[model samples]
Target: MAMGHYVNYYRLEMAQQREEEGEEAGVKRSAQYMALLTGPGFTGHVLALILFLMVTSSVERVRRKGFETFWYTHHLFILFFITLMFHGAFCFIRADTPPYCKSSPGSYKFVLGSLFFYILERTVREIRARLPTAISKIVLHPSKVLEVQIKKSSNQHGDGFFRAKAGQYVFLNCPDISAFEWHPFTITSAPEEDYVSVHIRIVGDWTTAFAKRLGCSFDDEQQFWIEELKNRTSNGVGGGEETISGVGVGAASGSSSAVAMDSMAFGSGASLMGGAKQRASASANSLQLQRPTEPTITLPRVLLDGPYGSPSEDAFNYEIAVLVGAGIGVTPFASVLKHIWYSVMQPTKIITLRKVYFFWVCRDRDAFEWFQDLLIALEEQNLTGFLEIRSYLTGELGKEEMDTVLMEARAAAAAAAARHFRNKHYYGGGGGDGADVGNQGFEGKGGEGDLLTKLHKPLGGSGAFPMEVMLGEEMNGSNETLSDARRDRDAITGLRSPTYYGRPNFDKIFGELALAHPQEHGQVGVFFCGPKPLGKTLHRCARKYKFKFHKENF
Candidate 1:
């Protein structure tokens, strides 16, 4: 029905046009009709298809290359919108233009508010990105994990302290990195903590480059600068048109150069061509300027943009929560664990979370070192049995070797416990019974730095967490250090149960949780951030046992 009506309307229009423009002229105009194909409308339509391709074709590459292709290509949206505006406001075929269409003019007025808000939001974001953020602490961890701990700049943070929920994240930008790219990482510190921290695992291209920048020398940095500039051509900086237009422009510096740049930003045709020549010439001049002899400070200027909420942000809402992470994905739960730790220590802190089960599954043993200190400390304090952490190491090792690892882990725990006891005893002088369990106090993070260091102190064999069992010597020296009753000590640490050798049995784990928390028919918040496959398995388990499961992925 619609096609028949359009056909009749088209015939009427052609007949009217024939009468007004005489038959010969009307026929010639019909032959030349290509209104939508050669102007802004065509450009906008082409850009739409390009953007669709960008989103669809780069799906796999985005995962491997750290979103660079997606990030850079997505900027074409600016051109897309601009061309769309031009396309809508102008008309090539003018049959309806004299008294415009009654139904609608164009989409511009309708989207004005949305466009303005987006522009405002981006302007604020760019302003925030321009500020320099200081990294207060850099804790280099094993397994290529680098933690850049930064404090909120008082001048920049403004008003109150920078606040975030347990499982939120922030977008990080480093000028030395790409100047435009920002990556997201989970907030690993508690909201109440003085400093904010992001644990970056050296995995993708951007992270690897950042690691290089941190360790490179002065000469290496200069070389990197040249290479980085050259790479910018493909990264959406340099252009053939700019190079051509900038030809024969004068020096790299001057008022005329500034004028040329401004002209280039808004000019077109021959004027734009000349401006591009000037810009390219200026760029070449810049490349020739003598390098600073005194190496400029090489520390990359990093900026932060958000404390955006993720799915796991609501973990505190549920009384019974299960926080799970695998590999670097454990960062979100770190914040939750810290929060839970504080809640356990300070009984008066108002919070709904009564219990938290943290599970960290890793592929390498060295990865355990990242959170070992914090988790061990949590276990040593026993935090009223409110926090339970479970680590699964899926590395390839024999049963005997696995047993050795388990024994070593237990012994490590026992040693930490002894240290907690002796550190207090020494602080109280030699008068108190060092082994007195009633006097144990591991409530606050005040002495966190000294927590492990105090363990290194010689307690004159009064042995809080002792150096009696050295894991290094035992693991290397013999197969004889393995224990039969090592399973008994698995429950010793509140941080985690025994480190399991393989993957977890999700069905069994959820069943146990469901049984334990069934008294009030309470909901168990199963929060996870990890591989999609594991999350899917967890989702099935949640559905089977009637638990609410939430996950956040990058």
Candidate 2:
């Protein structure tokens, strides 16, 4: 709509210029147009058009590569609006100029109200940005993600602290980096916390310099380690047993239908690359090491502009919410997850959210190592049935291929077990303590009592969630006490939720959710912050399933 308006206005301006110049003899239209450009009204008209074109192009995908260009060009609206008003008020050219020119007609009346509102909005924003603010802490995570914690004092609110909802974003500016540059980042910290926080992925020049100012620069050795970590997943060095906690059994069952867990055992081939794997692991660890939170020197003064609303902020309004985040797009969901934890922890806070399915898709495990501890902690909490996390690693094998390979590995393991069964007496086999409970058919009822005895930390309020109840009636023969089952931890992050090897199947996931919640046709909310391709896929699925879809637009 905006583009069409701009094009139409440009065409009309050109036609009027031709018409005005055609009235004069021996004056070429091109030469006359250039001459008119130096005049007051014509100058503003041409300047406004140029500003619109530059700002429009920069705001597109071009911002990803050159954000400084986008930021500077976008702010030209101040000049563009002023020039627009000047172009209208001058009224240098007109139709039927004899009578119209006598009256000194202008477009100022048409634009005055909107221009006034625009100025008022910026004034309020400027005042809010100048409010008391200071950097509380800074941590550099893996993948060059910078976490900044800011403490703010607000005079307008009675609480005297800056307040912003989870899943919202803020525009940050540091005079030390560039006095005029401001970048937007999603707030990763919950509002209940004392300070506001934002996780910035250092992808642009502004963010890179910002990280350096905070003492997050990596030495040569550290940079070498980062390169090695990228190739670690494919060398067969990553391996871990898969376990399903009793609290998350239903969610596991639902996910297993779409994504299969990796069960491929390593051989001599993996051992040959042991040194490389260790170095990669060590590098990842070094990158994740805590930097000095408070520097000896004074920290740079930072200004914040918003507690602005985003689509993901509406997540709590729905009874069932599905959050899909890809790469750094997971930032908003981090805030939402923390908010959910706080809301559930406090009994006084009432919310409509009952279940949340969070899907985090990263290219590799190292990309999201910083988020692992949070997931592990959330898994240990009492809100077991409320939250289910699924992390996908798309760097190595794909989903379908990984499933096929796992099937082949399971068959090979079965053949080896058969050979060992015949020589039990020679091997001195007397082990039946349910230590290998998760290694085989975990959905069976054979070792319920023994597995329950082995579980040390049962999830939820009481320790009697009933393994049979979670596994359903088919596995319900034991009268033994029920507790949370042991989880299958991921080798990369040590998260209880096993990471899949590829992208998710939105159709299958949405189909399962639709089946589970028949009454929530329009009530089920699907909030996504990710790449455009995946977001479009989710949007289509939402329509097919009759669910509400909200996407985070930059």
Give the alpha carbon lDDT tens digit for every residue of 388-475 in model 1.
7677666544343333334444444455557667766776634656555323432112333221112243212233122222111111
Tens digits of lDDT, candidate 2, 73-146: 77776676567656644444455645444355455777688889988987877887777776665554565676
Candidate lDDT scores, in order, read 0.57, 0.60
| Model number with the top TM-score | 2
The runs of at least 3 residues in candidate 2 whose Cα sits more than 4 Å from the true structure, single-residue gaps closed, are 1-41, 88-100, 103-105, 154-158, 221-295, 397-487
The TM-scores, one per candidate, come to 0.64, 0.67
Superposed Cα deviation of residue 359, candidate 2 (Å) = 0.7
- The clash count for each model shown is 12, 2
Taking all chains together, the TM-score of candidate 2 against the true structure is: 0.67
- Model 2 / residue 136 / CA error / Å: 1.9
